[model samples]
Target: MENFIIYMAKASGLIAVFYLAYHILLKKETFFNSNRWFLLAGLFTAAALPLLVYTKTIWVDPVPMAETATRTVTLEQLIAYKQYQQQMAEKAAIEAAAISINWFDVIVGMYLTGVLLFSIRFVLDFLSIRRILSGNIVMKDGRFRLIDSEKARSPFSFFNYIVYNSAQLKQEELAGIIIHEKVHSSQKHSIDMMIGQLFCIVFWFNPLVWMYKRSISQNLEFIADAGAIQVMEDKQAYQKTLLKITVQPDCINLTNNFYQSLIKKRIVMLNKQQSKKLNSWKYAAVLPLLAVFMLLFQVETVAQEKQPAIELIKLPEAKVKFAVQIDKNTQDSELEESKQLLKDEYNADVKYENVTRNPEKEITAIKVTVKDKGQSQVYEVAGHQPIAPFTIEIEKNNSGRNVITFGNSIGKDNFVRAQAFRIDANGDLQDLANDSMHVQKHKIIIGSYGMDGDKMPLRSSVPLKVPEGHWSVNSLKIGDTDMLIVINGVKQKKGDAIKLPLGQEIAELNMVKAKEAKKKYG
Candidate 1:
C-alpha cells in the first residue's frame, strides 16, 4: 500500500511537469495534430516513469587503516572502549523498541474514493448518451450516422453520430453542420476525450489533470473548426452558425458539443492567418524535456562499498551433558542399576544424583534431565565472549518449567547451494562464461534464459537484500561440478540459476576468475 502511494505521487509529479512544459512551450502553436499526440504521449510517459527507476551502483575505493607502531594498550584506553561499547548497545536496544505510524493510509483512502466517484460518473455519462441515441431518427451513410432531431438544443457529434435539429436550418446551415461534425467523426476525437476521462478518474485530486482534459477537448474543436471552414463558401456564415448554437448550447459530458466555450477565440482563429511552418519546431522541445525527466527522476544510484572477504573456520564437535535423578527412598543397588541404564541408553555424559532437598517429590526409576544447550557456542573476540549464530539457550525453573531455544546457525549445513551472478541494467543475468551474455551492451534474448521475469525455472534463484547485492542463482555450470554459490563469487555445490527482476534490483555480475577456480579445485 505504501508503494502504491509512492507510485501515484511520482506519476502526479510527472504529469505536472510535462503539462507545464506543454502549456509554456507548444500550447499556442497552430499544429493541432501534433498538439493532440503531445498531450497523449505526456500522459502515458508520466505513468511509466515511476516503474522505470533503474538502480545503478556507485563504487568507491576501500579506505585503508592508518599504520601505527605496535604497543601495549593502556588501562584507561580499555575502560574507554568498554564504555563506548555499552553506549552503543543501549542505543541499539532503544531504537529496536521504538514504533512508528505512517499517515499515508488516509491519503490513499481519499484518493481511491475520488477514483471510484469519477469512474461511476463517467459510466453514467456514457449510458445517458447511449439512451439519447437509441430512439432518435437515424440516417446512415458510409462512415456517419445522421440523427434528425427537433429536441436537441445544439449540434454535436458522438463518434460517427451527428445530432441536431435539421427541420429548423436552411440547406447551407445544415451543410456546414454536417461538415463540422464529419471532421469530428473522421478524426475519432471521441477516443482522445475518453483517454482524458480515464486520466481524470485516476488523478482526480490534481487540478492540472482537469486542465489537461479541457485542453484535449478544446484542441479537438480547433482541429474540427479549421477543417470545416476551408470548404464553406461563405466563411462569415460559418461564424454566424457558431453563434446560433452558442445561444442555446447543448452540454453533454461524453460528446463533442458544437457550442463549446471560447467562442470568441474560435472565431479569431478562423480569421487569423496561417502560422509559419518553422513555428512547428516547438514540438521538438518535448524530447529533451522528457530526457531531462529521465535524468532527474527515473534513475537511482546506491553506494556499494567493498568489504574484506570472510574466512569460515570449522570448530570442534560440541559435547552435550545431562543429569539422571533417582528417588531418595530407592535402595543402593536400585540406584546403581538406574544410573548404569541411563548412561548406556543416552550415550551422553550423564551424572547420577539422589535428591533429598525436595522430599515431597518422588522421581521415577531413572529420570534424565537434559540441560539447555542454546548458549553453548560462544567465541572469545578481543577478550569478550560474544554469542555466535551456533549458540543455544535453555532455562529451567523450580516449578519444573523448561524452555529451550535453537540459535540462528543451528541448521548451518542445510543451506541450498548454487552458482549466483549479478543482474544488470539491461534486465539480464550477466553470464561471464558466455561472453555474449556477459555485458549489458550485448543484446540478450527474451526466452526462458533471460531475466525479464516473464518465465523462470521452478526453483533456481533467491533474491538478496540491498547492499548484499541482488541475486543468488543455484548451481551454474563450471566444467562439470555443481556448486553452492554465495555473493556470485564463491561456489560449493550445484543448483539451478535463480530468477530475478534484473535491472531494477540486481547490480553487478561477479563470476569466479579462471585463476581462482584452478587454484581452488584443480
Candidate 2:
C-alpha cells in the first residue's frame, strides 16, 4: 500500500507539474480544478499494476508418464538421439516471446521516466516563483505577488507563497484579502488545488469537470470567508470591506481575496437553515461494488497449502519416433493456454517463432523455431521439433534456427485445450503460416472430446480458444519423439521450418486405460 501510494503520488505530482508548465508556457496561468479525478485515477492505476503482472506471470508443469511404444536402444539404435545431438544447441528465448515490449522497459523504464520528469517540473516551478516574488510589484517586499494571466484577470494561487496585487487595495481591503490568502496557505488549500489541477490534466475533455473545478475554487473562497468570520468581530465593517474589493472586475480566481463574492455566499450560508444529515445506514449503498472489487482483486490466504501436483511415469525406456509437418507463419506474440487432464498424460510444449521477420526491421515470411521436450527430464532443457528432412540430413542445412522451449514440455493428465492467454496489439496473434495444413490465422479448428467436459479423454481434447485458421490434429512427431497433441496453428520455426501443434489428438492408450480403470473401479 505504501509503495502504491508513493507511485500514485509521483504520478499525480508529474501530471500537476506538466500542466503547470504547459499553462505557464502558453497561458501564463495555473488552474486547480482536478481534485477527485487525480486522486481516483492515481489510486486505481497503482492498484491495478500488480493484477496485470499476475495475469502474465509464467507457470510450468512437469508431467511424467511411461512411454509404451518407445523401445530402448543403446549404442545400436542410439545413433539418432546421439547422431542428431551435434546439430542442435540452445540460446536465450522467450516462452511468451516479447516482440518489442520486454519486461524491463515497461516496468522499470516507465517508472524512471515518470519520476525524472516530475522532478524537473518541481524545480522549474520553484525557480519561476522566486523570480516572480523578486519582481517587487504591487506589494514591494510584501509577501503578496501578482502574476499576469489571460485566463483569470485576478486569479491567484497561494502555493507559490506570493500574494498577487494585494498592495493596490486600501487598508481595510488589504486586511480582508490578507486573511483569505493566509487561510489558503495555512489550511493547506494550495495542495488541494494542486491535486485538483492534476485531475484536470487527465480529464481536460470533460467540460462539466472544468466548470466544477472553477466552482470549487469559488466555493473555497466562500469557505475561507466563513472561517474569517470567526476572527473578525464587526460584521458590518467586514461586509463593507468585501463590498469595496468586489468592485474590481479584474479579479484573480486562484488567490484568496479579502473582498471576493465569497462574502455574499458566506452571509447566505450562515443565514440558511441546516439540512438534516443522513444516518450511517446509507453506507449500505456501496456494498455490491465493494464486494465486486474485493472478489476481483483481494488475495486469499491459503489455510492448507496443498503440495504441487507432480506426476511421473517411466518410459518402457524408449524414445518416440514419428513425423509431423507444420505450416510456417501462424504464431506471433505467442501465449500459453493451460488445460486440465484427468488421467496420466504428458505435455508437449510447442513454441513458435518468426525471428526471420527481423528484430530491427519488418519483413515478409517470419521464421519459426520449435523445441520439443517432455516432463521426463529435469535440470536439462532438452526438446526438439520435427526438423525439415533436408535440415536434418544436409550438412549445409545447418544454418536454420531452432526455438528453445522450457525443458520442452510441462505435464498433463487428460486432454489438451487452448484458452488464448494472449493477443497482440493488432487483435489476434500474427500469423505467418504458408503450409497447406495450417489455417489462415483468423480461424481456429475445434473438436469435441464428448458431450461433457469431464468426459474429455486424454487424447481427444478440443481447441477452446482459436485464432483464424487453426485446426485439429491427434498424433504427430516432435523432432524424434512420436507424440500426440492438439493443433492450434502450425507456425514456422527457425529459417523456414514449420512447427506448431494446436488442434491435435492425444493417443496414449495406456493412459486411457488407466483413466478407464479408475472410472470403472472407483
Best by lDDT: 1
Cα lDDT of model 1 by residue, 246-311, tens digit: 563646677887778888778877777767788877777667766787788778999786652322
lDDT of 1: 0.58
**lDDT scores in order:** 0.58, 0.36
Structural similarity to truth (TM-score) of each candidate: 0.55, 0.38
List, residue by residue over 1-522, the lDDT tens digit for candidate 2: 455544454444333433333233312111122322333343344334334322333343222122232111111122333334434432234434546756655655565665566556555655654555454544323454445322333434566353545445566655655565666656667665555454444434334334445544555665566566667676566666666555545433334444455456655654454423342222233345434544554434333323334222222222222212112221232112111110101233333333333343333332323323422211211123322211100001133322222211111211223212222443332222222322233222222222223232222222343323332222211132212221222222312212222222222212112333244333
Model 2 ranges off by over 4 Å = 1-128, 135-170, 199-219, 236-270, 273-291, 297-315, 318-522
Q: How many residue pairs clash in each candidate?
A: 19, 58
lDDT of 2: 0.36
TM-score of 2: 0.38
